[model samples]
Target: MSGCNKKKFPAAKDVVLLHQLDRGIFTPSISPFPLKLETYMRMAGISYENDFKNPMGPKGKTPWMTFNGNDYCDSQLCLELLASKFQKDFSSDLTAEERAIARSFQIMTEEHLYWVLVLWRWVYTKGKTLWDVQMNLPTGLRLVMPLAVRRIKAQASAQGLGRHSKDDVIEMGRKDLRAISDYLGTKPYFTGDKPTEMDCAMFGCLAQLVWSMQGSPYEEQMKGEFANLKEFCERMKEKFWPDWDQCLSPPRLNVS
Candidate 1:
């Protein structure tokens, strides 16, 4: 019997990311997963094109990537695939224990923190108002915004985080932020001076919470209490986003 050989895939030169628009620093991404993937690419020095339309790729999700000729979905899976293909390990310098710790925090951020963000944006009134303003939907499409909110609420409910009272959910999110802040005390990055996959994961979550969810109770709490986390986000933004000021400028409108 002949053994099946692994197919050698070509190195990806042109990579395209479909994600939400840049609405100033307030909301770098409407969804965190795509932001995570984008941050990862930047950290790895991989050049990619940004395509905002039709965010749901082949897998019906944002953050999906088109590499070479194939489509890859899910942030974690896409990271693994890109790392393997490019021979770049985001955690290559970490010790075994550090890697394990990073993985744990990454999972916590994605699984737990992400849901809290969803609830904050779609379920709560204050957060929903902020989201609407940042989204800046057209007057015609504004009528459907409530329907969109309802759909998101249903999704949150199915995901189980929405089952809890709003207070409980906020508390859970606060605890998560506290844990991350404590772990990140006085460090330039999550794993020390250098940014790792953990930092990428964390930056994705914290950046949105701190900058995008401004005026919400959660953001207020973070700013008032978690100094380290706020500093961490700022540091990352300065280091990775050299065009930060450009990103904040409003898009030029076309006049007829």
Candidate 2:
């Protein structure tokens, strides 16, 4: 769990070495999948360290991990690995139907909502807002952002969401948000009063709107029309991320 160093590559016994982007002044990690994995680790009480160096894993994705002297990639697969190893089952108490619902919600957030957020951050905003808040980003990355934008645009187009207008994309995101809020209702967590694995994915995507994406229509809608969603984000933040501010670069002040 060393800070600002990758020389200590292999984590201590039973400690997870998470490879992901550097922290931001606004959020723990800019990418939701990384944030999702990190949140799952925290929720499961698994000891871990943050390795900003070599963020990309074998699968060429950020937020990969090294654990028990083994390397792992893909955030969802990483979650499964950690869950099996740690024996942490947040959804263990759920009914079969509830588990099915949780999986569906996770897919909706990660698959559908994630693309919309990406379009807004990387494509629509052109990574300006994202770059502005990132701490100590490399000069190379700044130079490569244009390529990254093109890649994302191409991916979005292939996914079919990019074919729609910006307004249509915003509406799609709103529908997803509304569905989540409706399901959440007054529950302290997504299902019942206790957090589950699905909550990690849910919070990962929702936290972006709460803190990272400034002036986004989705952000405004969540803050205004979807009071429950806002409350759920705040509740998850308070419960799991007590060091949320400290985790940020140049630690954000006056955070509510």
Candidate 3:
């Protein structure tokens, strides 16, 4: 069959993504996991429909997937389920050691870098101000946003990243960026010419740092100090996102 002919057939199954709004644009919510899943699906060449039902899915998190008739929560679990059902192997070509390395990086980005993001965005005063402005809460509810902010702070503290001082947080983030840069070197992706789950994780976090958190100190530091990561974000954007330009555009805050 011709390549174009294959496009005529509908996808074997329907995949509905429940996450934040503004798909194909910058990270829409505070979390990057949802964007990671979306990017991974795109990279895997899977057709799926996006449904902005709520920021939190049935599991009280973003990036949950409903495949055919079954619900799968958690991005990693969703990826595993998709791979198993569709017979798609994202890491098939990887050696045992390579898979280990990739998995390590994935965990580092999620556990460490993710907390750095929370510290910068939810803990720091300047970051909180920008976040609030972008959030654009109503005048009546703006007074109560602090309560929500405090909840986030508490969550971050429990996660152990929000307890550090701002300088410490920045230093931690710098170390992570340096590590990712060193590992990537001149490679096109984390694993080599082809992208992997690790690449998805890295891109998801870096994209938010480089693009979504605009005007923040973290974003400035990433762009200035980590040129390679910035370039990698651009590469992934160009490769996986058809509307990269739109995604890069600054979000339209609903200030009313």
Candidate 4:
């Protein structure tokens, strides 16, 4: 891709201009992948800026970024590349076996659990839940919401998650949560005391349930049986997102 000649793209060297969906009322981003990448940047102390101008990048995915005028997409790939470039290894302390376990948890959260949430938010719930959190959506997006839901519905069906009943999807999510909870045990973070790349991805998904999936059983479970996970969300938010409230949509107005 050409250098950032477009006004929306950042021209600064060695600085990441993150292009992702607009922020939501309940979270900095209702989309987990972008939030994951942003959280990774925050944790690694990488210099970056958010650009809501172009939500879709070359690969047709949100959470893409421009570094040194080069565009990169895919949240996980971006995290790995940026980590190497910055010499930051959140999992550098992990043993070989521990690394394997962390990889498994990350895959479960991103692949399986992610589809579950997508089905719930788009297909099963018919985007009602998403509308609740993204209430301040732009007029253009409001017009496109129906088409977005249909596209997700087709994608979920193609992925086989939509073939299952709503109850089945919920059960799958519950089981995934149970596995994560059991593995997490009592550790302050996913891997151990300190957060890792896995935690960045995990928190990206779990925070959605904890904060944005209002009135859903998953939200209730996160706050109930999976209360530890809820606490984990709180911990991650406190550590990486001190400006959480300020990052919300409609902008939180401060009063003296």
lDDT value, candidate 1, whole model: 0.71
Q: What TM-score do all the candidates reach, one by one?
A: 0.85, 0.92, 0.83, 0.92
TM-score of 4: 0.92
User: Total clashes, candidate 4?
Assistant: 0
Q: List ranges where model 3 is wrong by over 4 Å.
A: 1-12, 23-30, 126-141, 246-254
Candidate 1's TM-score reads 0.85
TM-score of 3: 0.83
**Per-model lDDT:** 0.71, 0.85, 0.69, 0.86
lDDT of 1 at 191: 89
Candidate 1, residues 1-256, lDDT tens digits: the string is 1112133224446664434444443545656777677778888877777655545555556666666756676877887777777777867888999888878888898998898887877668624454332544334444576787788788888989988999999889889888888888888898888997778778888887777765666766677679788888898888888776665535336411
How do the residues 1-256 of candidate 4 rate in per-residue lDDT, one tens digit apiece? 3333344564578788888888988999998999999999999999998888688787677878888767788898899889988999988899999999999999989988999989888877778677677644555755677898899988888988888988988999899999999999899999999999999999999999998888776767787789999999999999999999989886334411
Over the stretch 1-256, how does candidate 2's per-residue lDDT look in tens digits?
2122243365689999999988977889878889999999999999998888778777667878888777878888999988988888888899999999989988998999999998998899888777556765666766789998899899999998988999999899989999998999989899989998888888888888888888888766776788888898888889999999889888434422
Candidate 2, RMSD to the unseen true structure? 4.5
Candidate 2 wrongly placed segments (more than 4 Å): 1-8, 251-256
How many clashes in each candidate?
1, 0, 1, 0
Pick by TM-score: which candidate is best?
4
For model 2, state the Cα shift of residue 82 in Å. 1.1
- Relative to the true structure, candidate 3 has a C-alpha RMSD (angstroms) of 6.8
lDDT of 3 by residue, 1-256 (tens): 0011111212246554444443433544335787788787887777787655344556556766666555667888887776776777878899999999889878888998888776666557624445432443234645665776688788888988788887888788778878888888888898888887778778878887876676666666666667778898888877887776554425455554
The CA lDDT at 85 in model 3 is 61
Candidate achieving higher TM-score, 2 or 3: 2
**Which one is best on lDDT?**
4
